[model samples]
Target: MDKEKVEQLKIQMQQWLNEAEEFINHIPPVQLYTAVGVVLFTLILLLIIRLFKRTTSNTIILTGLSGSGKTYLFYQLRDGSAHQGTVTSMEPNEDSFILHSEKDKKGKLKLVHIVDVPGHSRLRPKLDEFLPQAAGVVFVVDSVEFLPNFRPASEYLYEILTKASVVKKKVPVLLLCNKVDKVTAHTAEFIRKQLEKEIDKLRTSRTAVSDADISNEYTLGVPGEPFAFSQCHNSIIIAEASGLTGEISQLEKFIRENVKP
Candidate 1:
């Protein structure tokens, strides 16, 4: 019975196809030509959209102090695994792929180009290579060890926010406080306030020093008031994450918000 039904369906499909061809054959030549032209135009338009999406800025830069776990977070984003005990990466960990969180989506997502710039003092300069084209910047901070590294981290972040490339492009910055799984980890709000205070002091000191010393390409924060991130030209978002335990949804959200799939 099933076989007979299959054969009948096939025959019906063939008859329908023949009827469709006959109907198309009767269409006026000009109308048929117009229909073909419209289809071709639509196909070309879709192709252009695909090409444009492929070329759009997909870069998300990850940078922070050596021990802030930015490299670990980078691994988490790319592989969804911490790859524990990762020493300070000497070189930038860079790749282009669909985010690990979007792995199940196959073929329907855009590739993200992530540049995990090494946070070492020497390697930090390499960040400039990718910053100009970055869709967003994820600056990881070690919330559990926040106080000890606050100065250098603040200085590094200050330089970044003040850089000509970041300021001119107005690239959004995500202040990611990592290692949040730890009980000792600081809250995102506290971290933000401390960072603001540190940056405010640095801004004043930079102003006191020679313009060359500060590389004063673009002044940061308001001239008179204390430096709050809100005063900056670009948008700043504060969020927490735990790279080891893979609680990085907020981080992923920021990337998607800026770099469309």
Candidate 2:
């Protein structure tokens, strides 16, 4: 009895298919072609969108002065341990992995592509190659030695904020004050204000130069007002961390915010 019922259902399905075919055949060729094209186009469009989403960059760039401890932070993020004796990196240290802190968390985590670009003036050009695809840029500063390196650090941050890719994409930046484990490390607020002041100075002098001589692709801050991180096109926030002590919660938070788990 079940076999007989199954045979009847099969026949009914065939009849419905035949009817659908007949109806389609009766339609004008132009209408039929148009309908088919629409479906194919929709399917192709959906496929392209899916591919684009999958390929969207999950890169987070770590950049600042040579002694700013970017390489140490990079290792800490990847290994969840401060790699002792880390020196100023001569080249970009890059890797792709699920963040070490997230390893014990339940469920799937996305791979983060971190590039610690060397901060030497000569190696600075390498920063541009990664900026275009950066999910977020972390400008690490040595808060312990903030006063001494303040000018150069601010200058580097200024260049980053004014980059064509950074401005156009409006990439979010985290001003990370590193080495806060030391008793004398400056506060994030202090570092932020000083950076703003120094960058304002840079803006004035650079704008005075002829456009031909200016290297920055975009101007930072409002013309009449003092330069602040808020004046830039991108969203900028300040956070503190200690790469040597492995206290990098803020840094990980910024990463997870930009590159979803």
Q: Estimate each model's TM-score.
A: 0.77, 0.83
- The TM-score measured for candidate 1 stands at 0.77
Against the reference, the lDDT scores of all candidates come to 0.90, 0.91
Structure candidate 2, residue pairs in collision:
none
RMSD, candidate 2, Å:
11.4
Model 2 whole-model lDDT (C-alpha atoms): 0.91
Q: Residue 169 error for model 1, in Å?
A: 0.7
Query: Candidate 1 residues 192-248, lDDT tens each?
Result: 999999999988887777767767357878778888999999999999999999999
Q: Give one digit per residue, the lDDT tens place, for model 2 in 1-261.
A: 699999999999999999999999899999999999999999999999998874467999999998899988999999988774287788889999999989998998999999999989999999999998898999999998889999999889988998888888789999999999999999999999999999999988887778876665798888899988888888998999999989999999999999988
RMSD of each: 14.5, 11.4
Estimate candidate 1's alpha-carbon lDDT, on a 0 to 1 scale.
0.90
